[model samples]
Target chain A: MERMDLEALNNELLDAVLEKGSLSFVVNRLHQALNKGVLICDCLGRILIGSNSEIEYDIDAYIAKAIDHSEAYYYDQEICQLFFPIGWGKLIAIIIVREVKEEEIENILPVLETANLSLCFYFSKYNAIREVENKYKDLFIQDLLFNNILENEEILAKSKLWGWDFKKEYFVAVIEPDNFINIKTFAEELEYITKKLAKENDIEIITSVRSGTFIVISREKNNQKERVKEMIVEKISRANKYFSEKYDTTFSIGVGHTYLAYKEIYKSYQEAKTALAIARLIGETKFVKYFGTLGIFKLLYKQEAYLLKEYYYETLHKLIEFDKNNNGELLPTLDALISNNMDIKLTAEALFIHVNTLRYRIRKIEEILRIDLSKLENVVNLFVALKIKALLKLHYSDID
Target chain B: MGYGFLFNIDACIGCQACAAACAKKNDFFLGFRRVQKYELKYRGKNVVFYYSNSCNHCENPECLRRCPERLYFKRRDGIVIHKMGECRACLTCLKACPYQAPKFNHQIGKVSKCNLCVDETGDPLQPKCVKACPTFALQLVHEDYYQPMAQYYHLPIDTIGKSHITQPSIKIIIPPELQKNGEN
Candidate 1:
């Protein structure tokens, strides 16, 4: 070969090394060194990549069939190679034991090393670029999303992001695992399931961000929030059952309602997460949806009198005393009052208690307190009072 | 009882600074570790995180029980240390560690575990992992006090107790919410 021709070939090889820098590049470089007849086999004598089309071997098979000695081995009118790769184990990449001289194998090893080194350089350069880009992106997002940190009132006031379209709804769901140690495969599985569900629904899920929580932004009308919530509850239930059966541990899900602005998004996320905690406290299995159903707690928190007055605590205390006095009827009445928002029929159906019994309990409480519980506004007040009472006890108990 | 390290999983950003520091601190040959970060998934989100792993210096060290040469020894402070010179390269101790604490050194032809940097001159009584953890994910706590410290915050009391292997005195103080959410 002419000197110019060899130089041109070198340049081409160098270009290949720089551009397609990976295992394939090493294979190509080795092929060039071996006059394109080299076969790369794993330790198991299975041909990894090769020029020989007829050779058949798996990783384990390659280990079994490859010649033990360094010398070339020919069997059944075919040539093969075998050698172990460094920094790995017995069942790793294949070695080619072919009709090659000692000088040829030694010469090709350097070329293969050079190709691998060149590839490593390329990867490092790519990784450096990636690292800078990721750092900038993370910084940008953190500044954009959380610039309004606590006590940064002036910064928060100046931060003018557009209001989210209230027409579109969002939900925050946190996936927490008990032992989040060395479980990357499980995360991939979850992402797969979420993507699949979103695709099947034909809904363009906005804000499908993954942080501590997998916050999915879905479009929901005010009327459709219930339906969407139910769907999520069902999905989580199914997933938990499947996971539990497979892993023998219950997986908890904390789901928050969608908000209009990014600011409210964090609150919703926290609320959903807190709801998950409450669910666990109650020993509810599988999943917990926040803000959608808090039973009596929802109404209790919703009422103004409960927020402003301390009457609820007193009312609950009295009811507890009555219950201890062998009166189990008042507790159900209190639950009914809150569940139905002081409505008799709804409360009766919700508790599965008799409406007459509910009426009698309310009348008895009215007589005890010297207040007319029959009045609509008074009934509402009493319901709120009971919730405040229960909440205080729970909060104090938790503190202790 | 020996005090061990704690990993705050929430604070661990998975930078691998601790792992690199561990490798450098121990002068670890290929694949050996005094400490390293671990990760897991929660719900469906990629909660990218890490934790420091090391010898728990168990109440009952599996490595000690399984050591053929009986080279593994427990100190008064709950550290499980070994003399590399005495090891016969028999890998039974590696198999016995539930946490996989001990690593084989092919170059030295002996087994190695985190020495708590005791051999190093003028060193504080701390492992390379705790000293190097940028996010304070790893900390060498006094064994007796760490349990009550965790229990004070309503966290689980029996982390190492449930393992039933060598009762390594080390424990992790993760976000209380994390265990409630999804921690196995």
Candidate 2:
């Protein structure tokens, strides 16, 4: 009898275990070599694969007992049964052998050990492959979320394989941590906790992390859009509170409107991303934001980049040119003035400059641009132009 | 938890010897090794700099995650290697990488990149490029030793969506001129 070299088995069989039909081929080969019926089952004793007639036996109780003990067992009687545990504790399968002879039991022990090792290899490789597949699914979801130009058929096929129903109504939620050092681990933890909440609340969710941002696609269980939005918001808030306390960090969530179709869900993702961006831009104090609440900025953001750039240039081109030519602080002064609600004293204080110097810079800006800083319309235009410029900068600076 | 590379930019003479040796050792016909020379004007003085960079073998590699074919894997000692046979020619990893490590092999219709010469020499051994450097510019150092140098050099540890996002494992020594001028 050849003693099984466990190290050699692992080294040789690691990659082969993930190949299709390999497990069945291994089990069949083992069955022929051992001259006994073989059955492979999951931890729950559900038969996954088998060879010969051993699978017909109702050995679930024996398999369960073996799994509970996490050891091998044999019935000392005619037509003996043998149960061997495969895989590590809490995650294992059972290999059942039927009609074993008492005299052949010693000869069969080594074969069963080899078979159990092979099964363990298969389970480990299966888990790794499944993880890779899940990552691929997440990448596909990201493409959909960003509205990448994808074929409908390809989307449907990929989603079907991942067990996701995109035809149903769904909303996108973007969760971002304030200061996360290990984003991958954080994303995994967030996904686990969020999935638990979804299960308890009877909601469906598909989550992916891209560029350190946690994206979740929540399936709307009811037709009421407003109610779904409220529920999602409440659930996210609770989750955020728990995670913030647990992780000793802050979390901000952005929610997008629910859409009915797969293609249209990208718009929801875009909205969620936009909301998150706006929240980060505004301040960290407001931890949650919704796309529906960003009335004017949403309209402004939707405009063509060139059109917005033209408007920005028309309004602030002179100041920008002056600043570029002389490396002046005119733009900063103007920004401070507008941000401080046109208060010269406050603007000067914010810019760390004297009021007289502030006045001089403001006079220079007005003289160059021919726009009065005191007028509400002019201030609004300058403010919007600045916001548009910031928006464009953000859009351009975003790395793929 | 493993080893990383340290590049002393000041010691590099822009000879391209490391690049040539790497290409020769790896049989890289399409030029896998890149040596970039840049000029900067600082404090009324003209300064020239040379940067020899390859894959950083990032802690959280975007190449591994974004590869649609799942061809990339990290070894125990942190060297990221890719299987060319499994590549789908998507080039998503190319776009996702901040350092632009992975390159397209036009002839083969797939993507290929530096594996830190893991096939030729395993972990705890000097990579081909590090061994080939005439100036002793490239040294394979432990992560603990490299982190402080990276911080002192003020090398941008994180780019908006690239090295920072991926947590690349490579460390750099800033050019003396840039350090003097407080520019990186």
Candidate 3:
């Protein structure tokens, strides 16, 4: 908007290659130049970069108006915030300035324009780097997951070229987004933020996107098993929370067992995918599940879902039918019994019934299924069948 | 209903061997599976991609709705079975499919599409085209309604056809080298 401001922005452009690589630094420089808080929000109004005070602002409602170039300011008594959209065509990533006066707009517009130019430059640079990085990383991940590398030595050599250490014990984590929301955009942001946070935490990580799920391979620095699990859970859950809050979407994380050999990373990746599938099947969206802890589910998930459903019906249909016919609570009683390890007292207490009543229900279940609950094999069968019933019921919409 | 095909765009060579395999296995005059090619401009560079498509076996099938006789139906595993004997050759399916999946056979005076090799392996379901791909470019992917957007890995529907209308159950992986993250 001014000749002098244009010269100043041009001067900064030449020195940009010397500054630390980040968009926030540019936004911070703009904040210092203007003496007002500034932020760059994506189309969804999620603050991608903020400088000075990281204040939470409920600006989502005005995003459409800001993008449409309708009203540049959301006014209270006067202009409290100014919006300058930064993109092409329907392009609307807003630059919102806090507490900027309308009188100062004549002078501020030029500086804002310079900020917009700097943002574009940074974005273009990021795209250039990401394009080349993603190209090779995708190929490397494909080789790791699908193509057999022939020998551990081969992967060790390849890892060295990628600036990753295959010698470190690595655990593969697969995160699947639970809903639709500008996914490619989210994936880019996720890659940037995850890497940044990992670096800050001093955790070594290599990330790649394949088939829409984010595949993250991070080194296990801790020797204690519990500490490693805790650290990973903490790191991933924190990242998940940030994305869920920012993007209005949830992600399911599945972690596989740690592997010592470079070649075995593929196995861990497969196991993580399996774990993610089971987490989806059982509706365990709240936790980061490990494949080793899945127990019987690990085996059951490998089977065809329809076959599992069929087995569920064959094993428990009689009890279900009886319950429907008589309005009995036998099914719940059996579940409680199996869950309690056939402890008559605990089952009775859980069901809020007498011990005699629990015994009566157990006998009825055994007779109906034609198996003795005292036998471990029969109990195992009932347990597996009940688990299958739970799994299928949660996901019955797929079949119907 | 969640069963679908995942096509790897980068891996495909556009050989049309999948089309031939579909025709041979099903004994039909027209192959149910066909591969479509797209040449697109990404970041000011031309990139050509091949998409091997078949009956998407959508959750809400157009043939099942448009056919006055309701000859087309989806099974539990999401395969759209065109009951060969029941079709009166109304040709509604041929007109309804967005992907042009169904073919009208003048010789048989009926319509047919992919059975997904369901009759081959009944429980798990299989596709002859997937098995025929030498590059392993195609595989079956399953999903639950509650799960995340697993199919978003596919090429955007606008890049190929109006896929959102039928909500086709196919995931076509975008070639990895293009780097489409920027708005350019």
DockQ of each: 0.01, 0.02, 0.02
The digit string of per-residue lDDT tens for model 1 on A37-120 reads: 545553323344664454553334344443443433323223334243422222234434355554455554544433333444
Model 1: residue A184 alpha-carbon error in angstroms: 6.2
- Runs of candidate 3 with Cα error greater than 4 angstroms are A1-33, A37-53, A56-69, A73-81, A90-93, A148-154, A222-230, A238-248, A282-287, A301-315, A327-380, A390-400, B1-184
Error of 3 at A98 (Å): 3.7
Worst ten in a row by lDDT for model 2 chain A: A391-400
Which one wins on TM-score? 3
Candidate 1 lDDT, B1-184, residue by residue in tens: 4467666767777776766777886664533343334333434444444445666666545566456565666654556678788788889888767666788887888888877777777745766667777778677777453342223222222232123223357665566444533443
Q: lDDT values of the candidates?
A: 0.52, 0.69, 0.70
On a 0 to 100 scale, what is the lDDT of residue A327 in model 3? 93
* lDDT (tens digit, per residue) of candidate 2 on A207-323: 888656788888767434334656766666676655565556767888888886465676676567667766564344337778888766756644555576688889988988899
- Residue A307 of model 3, lDDT score: 77
